[model samples]
Target: MTVTFSYRSRQTWADPWDDYRALRDEDPVHEVGDGQFWVLSRFDDVFAAARDTATYSSANGLTTAPDDMAGFDEKARPIVMMDPPDHTAMRRLVSRPMTPRQVAPVEDLVREFVTDKLDAVADAGEADIVEALFKPLPSFLVAHYLGVPTEDRVLFDRWTERIVQATAESAAQDGPNQQAFLELFEYAGGLIERRKADPGDDLVSGLVQQGEDVASAMWIVGFIFTMITGGNDTVTGMLSGSAVLLDRHRDQRRLLIDDPTAIPNAVEELLRLTSPVQNLARTVTRDVTLHGTTIPAGKKVLLLFASANRDEREFGPTAGQLDVKRRIERIVALGYGAHHCLGASVARLQCRVALEELLGRFPDYSVDESTARFAAGWSTRRYEYLPLTTN
Candidate 1:
C-alpha cells in the first residue's frame, strides 16, 4: 500500500492540532488518507500506545531526530531507542542525577547559571532573548554538568545550533555546524577518556563511577548532544513562548509579578500548552490494533503528544485554558511511561530558573512578534529565535 503522508503535504503549524481535533470528534482512529497510517489524537489513545511497547517500536528510531545531526542515529543508537531490558539497564546508569534529592543541591548552580546569563543582558536592556539569554543557559549548564571545559562552551553552543537546525535556511546554513560536530566529537571522546582516568565531582564523573565503558562512553557523548539539543532547544522555546504569551496576557504577567510562587506551576502549564516537540514516531513490529485501527506491522504511527496534551476527552471544558494554578501532569511532550525524558527534572529546572531570573532581572519584558521565528519542522516545533525588549 502506498502511504499518503498527509501531514507532510500542504503543511502549516496548526495542521497537526486541527487534524487531531477533527479526529477526536469524528473518527478518533481512522486512516487519514489512502495508503496512509492511522492517527490516535485522543489522550487515552496516544498514551496507551506510548506505554505499550509490545506493538509500537522506537527501534527504527524516533523520526523527530533532526536531519542535521550527522551521526545522530549511530550515536543515539543507545537507550533512547531501546525498548525493553536494554532501555531499562542503560537508563539506570545516570538516573540519580535527575531525581529530587539530586536536583535540589544543583539549585545553587541553576541560580548561578541564570544570574550570569541574565547579567550579560541586564546592561544592554535590549537583547534577543534566544541569543542573549535562552541560548547560553543550557549550553553553559550542559557543558558544566558534563565536565566539559569552560573554554569549550562556545564550541558546544555552535554545534548544538547545527544539530538543532530546523529551518531550510538554517539547514542550508549548517556547513560549519557539521564540521564543528566532527571536531567536538573527537574532543568530547577524548574528554570522556580523561574522565575515565580521573573522574571528578561532575555528572560525567558519575557516569564513570557507574562503570561506563567505551560503549557507554559513546552513549554519554551522544546523550550530551541529545540532551543539549532536546533540553536546550525545548526550554528555549518554552522560555521564548512564555515571553510571547505573557506579552499577550498582561494580566498573567501581573499575576506572576504579584506571586513568584506561581512560577513552577506556570512552567508546567506553559509546557503543556506550548507543546514544543509536536509528535514522535514509533514503527510497529508486530500486528496490533491501536485506537480502533489495525496496523499490519512495519508501519509508523505518530504519537501526537501536542494533540494529546489538549485532548478534550481527558481535560474537560477548561482543557485549553492557560491557568497557572492548573496542574498538567501526564504530558507526553517529555515522552510517557518507561521512555519518558530521563532529563525531565533538569529541563524543568532550566526552564524555571531561566524564566525566574528573566523576571527578577527584567520584570517588564515584551516580545517583539515581528522578529520572532519558529522551528521549520512540522514534526518537532520550537522557536528559531525569540526577540524581546525590556521597557
Candidate 2:
C-alpha cells in the first residue's frame, strides 16, 4: 500500500500518525512530487541522513519551498541554511550565552516570570493559558535576550505569525509573506546597529561586537528571524501541547504532581511525543539509496522528526503512547546532527521551569478541550488559544 503525505495537507496537520505508521512500515523512503522530494519516516534513516551533512546538504534551504521563497536577497543566508565550518562559526558567535551554564544563572529570572504569570490567573481559576501564560513567557524571554523593549515585544509575536502563514503551504506557491519578512529583516538590522553603538549585556549587543562584515550582518538578521519564529513558537507549542497531553493522560500528570523531580524527564518525553517542529527539509547532495529506493542528487528530503520520535524500532511497542518516565536515549525532537537547535538548552530550561511552576501551583489543572484552538501551520505545532481550569 502506498501512503501519500505532504507537510501542507490539512489532514496531515490534524492527524498524521496513521499515515506515518503506514509509511514507516511499508515505505520508509516515501517519495512525493515524483522526483521533487522524499520523506524519511524511520528513526535510523532520519538520524543517519541528519548526521551525514556532506551527503544531505542544507545549502539549498531547510524548507521544501524554493530558496528565494522568503523574499530575502540572494546573499541573505540564515545559519539553518548553511553547513559545517561556516554554520559552526555563525552558531558559535551567539552559542555561549545560550549554553546550559550561561542560561542557569537566569533560572531565577525565568521562575519569577513563570510565577508572575501563574499569579495573574490563580484567582480566576480559569484562563486561556496559551494567551495568558505559555505564549507571553517565551516571547518575553526572547525579547529580553534580544534587548527589545517591553512595548515592542508584541511585534515578535506578530512577526512570527506572519512568517508561519507564509510557509503554511507545501510550496508557498504565491511566495512568502514579503511584507512580514522585510519588516522583520529591517527591524533586526536596525536593532543590530543600535547595539553596535551602545553595547549591552544582551545577545544582540554581544553579536554586533563580534563582527563588522557585511555577510555577518546579513546572517545576523536571518538568525534573528530564525530565533523569533523558531525560538518563540517551539517553546509555546511544547508547553501548550503538553498541557493538553497531560490533561488527557491523568496518570502522567499525577506522576509529575506527586514528584516534581520527574518534570525534567517528562519534558523530554513530552517533546519526543509531541514534536512541535514536525519535519525539516534537506537537499540531497548526491544519489543516496535507502531500503530499495534510489533518491537522485539535487532532490529534497524531509527528516520526519515527529514520526521518527515515535518509531517502535527505536522506542519499542509503546512508542505511540505517552510515558512520562520513559527513558529517551536519543530523539530528534529538537533535530539532530550539525543542525541541532542552537537554543535547545535554553528551550529545555524554560519548559522545565514553566512546568515545575505550573504543576506545583495547580496540580489538578485541566484543559478545556472545547475552547482549544491550534494555529493553521504544518511545519511547527502552535496553539492559538488553550483554555485551562485550575480544577
Candidate 3:
C-alpha cells in the first residue's frame, strides 16, 4: 500500500495518527511531492536524522517549503536554522538566561499569572480557553521572562502573534509578516541599546553584556525574536491541546487531579501526545540511506516529530493512546540534538503550573468540541479557540 503524505492536507491534522501509523508501518522513508522532499515518520529514523546534524544540515533552512518561502533569509532566520559553530555560539549565549536555575525563579510568577487568568473566568461558567487562558498566559509569561516592560506586553504579544501567523504557513506572503519583523527588530534594538547602557538582571541585558561586536547585537535581536516566536505559540498549543485531551481522557485527568506530583509527568506525556510543532525540515548535506530508501544530497527532509513521538516502536503498543501514567524515558517532542529547544524547561514549568491551577479550579470542566476550532498549518498545531464549560 502506498501512503500519500502532504503536510497541507486538512485530513492530516484532522486525524494525523491514522496517517502517521500508515507512514511508519508501510513506508518509513516516504517521498512526497513528486520527490520534492522526503518525510521520515518512524521513531528511530527521525531521531537519527535529528541527531546526525552533520549529514542533515540546518544551514539552508528547516522547513520543507521551498527556499523562496517568506522570511527565509540567513540574517533573519532563527538559531534553529544554523548548524555547527555558529549555532553553538548563539545557543550558548541564549541558553544562559533560560537555564533551569533561571527558569525556576519564574515558577512563582507563572503560578500567579495562571491563577489570575483562571480566576477571571471562574465565575463565567463557560469561557474560551484559548482566549482567556491559553493565549494570554504564555504571552504574558514569555514577556515577563524576556524582561519586556509591563506596559509593553500587549505590543509584544501582538508582535509575536504576527510573526507566528506570518511564518506558520510556508506559502504565506502577508505584508504584516515583514512589517512585524522590522518593528520587532527596531523595538528589540532599542531594548538592546538600553540594556547595554545600563545592564540589568534580565535576559536582554545578559545578551547585551555578553556582546563584544556588532554581530553580537544582531544575534541579540535574533535571540529575542526566537524567544518570543518560539516560546509563545508552542506553549499556547500545548496548553490548549492538553485541555482538549484531558477532557476526552477523564481518567487520565483524574490521575493528575488526585496526585499533583503527577502533573510533571503529565506535562511530558502531553507534550509527546500533542507535539505542537508538528514537523521541521532539514537539508541533507550528503546522500544518505535509511530504511532501504536513499535521499540524495541537497534534498529536503521533513522530520515528523509528531509522528515519531507516537511511533509504536518507541512508545510500545499504546503509543497512540493517552496514558499519563505511562513512563516515557525520552521524548523527541522538543526536537533532538544541537538545536533542541532552549526553552524546554520554561515550557514545562509553565504547562505544569497551568495544569495544576486549571485542573484545581475547574476539576469538572469539559470542552465544547462542537465549537472548538484549531488553527491550520502542519508546521505548528494550535487551537484558535477552545470553549470550556466550568460546570
Which ranges of candidate 1 are over 4 A from the true structure?
Answer: 1-11, 14-16, 30-33, 64-76, 166-174, 209-216
Ranking by lDDT: 3, 2, 1
Tens digits of per-residue lDDT for model 2, 1-391: 6688876443335577888899899989998887778999999999998899999888887777655336655455787888998888777777888888899998998999899989988979989998788877777778778888667777866776667556554333344467777777788888888888888998888878877673467766776776777787788888888888899999989999899999999999999987988888888988999998999898889889889999999999999998999989999999888888888888899889988998889989988877677776767876768889988
Clashing pairs in 1: none
Q: Which rank order by TM-score, best down to worst?
A: 3, 2, 1
Q: Which structure is stronger by lDDT: 1 or 3? A: 3
For each of the candidates, give the backbone clash count.
0, 0, 1
Residue-level lDDT of model 1, residues 131-206, one tens digit each, is 8777677667677778877787777777767766633224533667667667777877888788888888777777
In angstroms, the error of model 3 at 144 is: 2.1
| Alpha carbon lDDT of each predicted model | 0.71, 0.82, 0.83
TM-score of 2: 0.93
Candidate 3 lDDT, 282-321, residue by residue in tens = 9898998988999999899999999999999999999989
After superposition, candidate 3 runs with Cα above 4 Å error: 9-12, 68-77, 170-178, 212-215
lDDT of 2: 0.82
